[model samples]
Target chain A: MTPDPAAASAPGVLVTGAAEEEVLAAVVVALRRLCAGGAELHLRAPPVLDASVADRAGYSTSFPHLLGAVSRGGAATDLVLTPAACYHVYPLFEGRVLAAPAEVSVLADCHRQEATTERGRLRSFRMFETVRLGGAEDCLAWRDDRLDRLGHWMEALGLPAERRPANDPFWGRPGRLLASAQRADRLKWELSADVADGVRQAVVSVNHHKEHFGAAFGIRTADGEPAHTACLGVGLERLLLALHHAHGPTQERWPTHVRDALGLTRSCTN
Target chain B: MTPDPAAASAPGVLVTGAAEEEVLAAVVVALRRLCAGGAELHLRAPPVLDASVADRAGYSTSFPHLLGAVSRGGAATDLVLTPAACYHVYPLFEGRVLAAPAEVSVLADCHRQEATTERGRLRSFRMFETVRLGGAEDCLAWRDDRLDRLGHWMEALGLPAERRPANDPFWGRPGRLLASAQRADRLKWELSADVADGVRQAVVSVNHHKEHFGAAFGIRTADGEPAHTACLGVGLERLLLALHHAHGPTQERWPTHVRDALGLTRSCTN
Candidate 1:
């Protein structure tokens, strides 16, 4: 079945790499393709060492300055990539994009057994709920960073963009704490008609969380405050599934769009 | 750090595929490798008809027939592989061991977004809970059909092999349900010690889902229960951070295990 045109055009792909190697491989391939096509790439790297390192080295430093070294190059960079053990940390690298070699690759390896457990799931669920409700602004702040980045990319490309606060219904409504809590974090963007093409062609990366199941895109209707936005996820396997769905398995016969996105040239045999 | 020798010897790997093509690609490659070594393979495939067709053919009729086809291959087949989506309909496929094509692979394309999501970190947690509740036994039973086939291969090869219930604590406990009630509609698997080595050596066919977060595997303890498992997930961009962590991006070398697993045989030329 055809996906909703809106979703198809504004597709959001979700990719998972089984291991660190696979994740990097997919990202590296994507970066190479994007950069090679002259698409501006953004890189964000949050320092692993804390300010204590500066004290040890006899260097007094501000967090911004320390982070600046990591975030420099902004739009000049071809990819914005960072390591975040926790999702909350992702926003710290916001506003700063770095430049690196097209071939440069990062590897984040985590063991599932190590990271997840029944207890862990429960803790995460609790933490997620708590932070989401108690720290609504913080959550909005994280989301803002991403939305702002999209704005930045648009500006860099000289595309017309517009930012408008959505008239979200749940923004100030009271009843359920979760409902009131959700309003604490909300942001929306509407690109100018001129950049509609760019927005249509653009792909937004969404980091998955359980909360995402409820609100994947964070978009809400003017009156339908809780009406979550539609997100287009690219299931690593499902993408292949889509490929098979649209085209056959043979790489030679893959859709031109997919091939181009993946930077896969037709093999002579194909 | 070196993984535990016992763990390494009995390493468990989970490979997710996107579509049947990608799944087949990964399986074929893995099978070729194992076939050359004359190794035995076990597999399990749950019955999953196309959604459109599922309604017409009740699951009872569909599942057994599918299982029968897989069992018909008997001991000659060295590896086992199956569609993960089947698990959604047939939760019983979890604990059972099956004779696969000498290699096992699952399509992980659907999990790309899930892997990278905040919830992705909870994969192990999900596995632990799923197994602990004995919810995976039915899935295991489904898988056992194929394991029985593999047993035939072992018997024919004069290889000492036996199938016994795993005693992993994670798979033995019963617990209150967590996550959304809808999760009950999805399929689940528990790891078994007997299946760990095959999983590790097996090449997982990933799409974007599994690639986004990391790779996940199921593990079984001595009591035939799925205890602890691991998912080697690295955010695509996080890898670069990790590289910086281990050694500066320039003139760097990853840990031996990391390098070996990724098949990164060469130094960074760029």
Candidate 2:
């Protein structure tokens, strides 16, 4: 019997076997190269973040529907499962003034309470993120550059993906305005690919936070202005799912170019 | 200013730099070699576990004080941040009968709500676990064999540690009996090392569960008997903390043998 991808390991949990792990490693290497230079890789981040930090990030208020809290005996604790990887990076520079642009690469096991159990909508997932922080122009420029590169990376991997304007699923009516404003400001863009039969999902998200976190955390730019931030996150599991959907669940048969792009050498069985 | 390891990245989060990452990779390689053959490596698992799984594992009943629940708002969700890596392994074999012994190596970001926050007692930590499930004789034999090998591995790494009888922090009065019984039966052993000044913490835990998980999850051996289970877990960050305490904080200044054992070549700098 085949293992249910979501429940194979645990609910909303996707466990990677040898072949999948190889592909993920290759993908990460490719991503780091694509990021070029000056990116510091923070190999691990806590799966949980402080509740106050989450509140300051406006996550609890902006997307309460997707939030998950850590508790003891059904009573709320001061911690929450990290909703995003970049959340860990921002707090590291709290109340600090950056002399130059900072780019940090982080990988975190992120959690979200999903209402759906679709192929790509996992409750728990791995987020491969790169966060850039500095002046507004630098952050926005980096976001734009990485967005295009990520779109091209997907194409190079033989994934039929599109880069499109997007918005977070903010909750309620006020959220609707926020979503509208986000789109109007071009604050978010996603690289989406089909992970099921005609069911497309966003595998890569490029977000620009215009002083939202900087103002909240008191991170200032060289000129004493609130530092702007941008992040690019790749949902590793969803990307694997997309690859499986596109290439018959087997990596050997994938196009040669795609394999080379991902550094999946012929000898790399595992 | 040095960042507080606990709060550097986030509360209970330990972020690894380039050098630390190198050491960890080397350590994993050595552990895998020590495990020998017939081991399947599961590279990733969900940070959260289903509440039912936790209940069946007796984790909540035994260690209620250390349990962390995943909730939405203040209400409990069906999920809990995984307390251990082996919890993810059992569900995979649910209702299955194994023809041969199974050995699975898994790495998961585990969480615990400890009453204290010290260098080794992290709220969130990485657990590198290998679970063996089969006949009682095979399980216990494998547990004992691996326990000694792990102890030797720590010694080879130049960490002064001790392997001693240990018991889970079972809850309440009835739990005391369970702890005493466990100790009397020699069911649990830990490799404890000094993580701080006079603070010795358990960096590795080896436990044998005689038919506990197998019966709960309906797993059976070839003879149709409940499969026995045993697990060996290395608290990766704690080991790192221990290494820092034993050797100097700088990997370059560590004993040549220790650095060589960890594959931290002098030329290998972050």
lDDT of each: 0.24, 0.84
**Stretches of model 2 off by over 4 angstroms after superposition:** A1-7, A40-43, A266-270, B1-11, B40-43, B263-270
CAPRI classification of candidate 1: incorrect
Candidate 1 chain A least-lDDT 10 residues: A122-131
Poorly placed runs, candidate 1 (over 4 Å): A1-28, A31-87, A91-252, A255-258, A266-270, B1-104, B107-166, B170-262, B266-270
Residue-level lDDT tens digits of model 1 in B162-270: 3432211111113123222213533222111121223211111111111111111232333544422211111212222223333343322535443333333333311
The candidate that wins on TM-score is 2
Which structure among the candidates has the greatest DockQ? 2
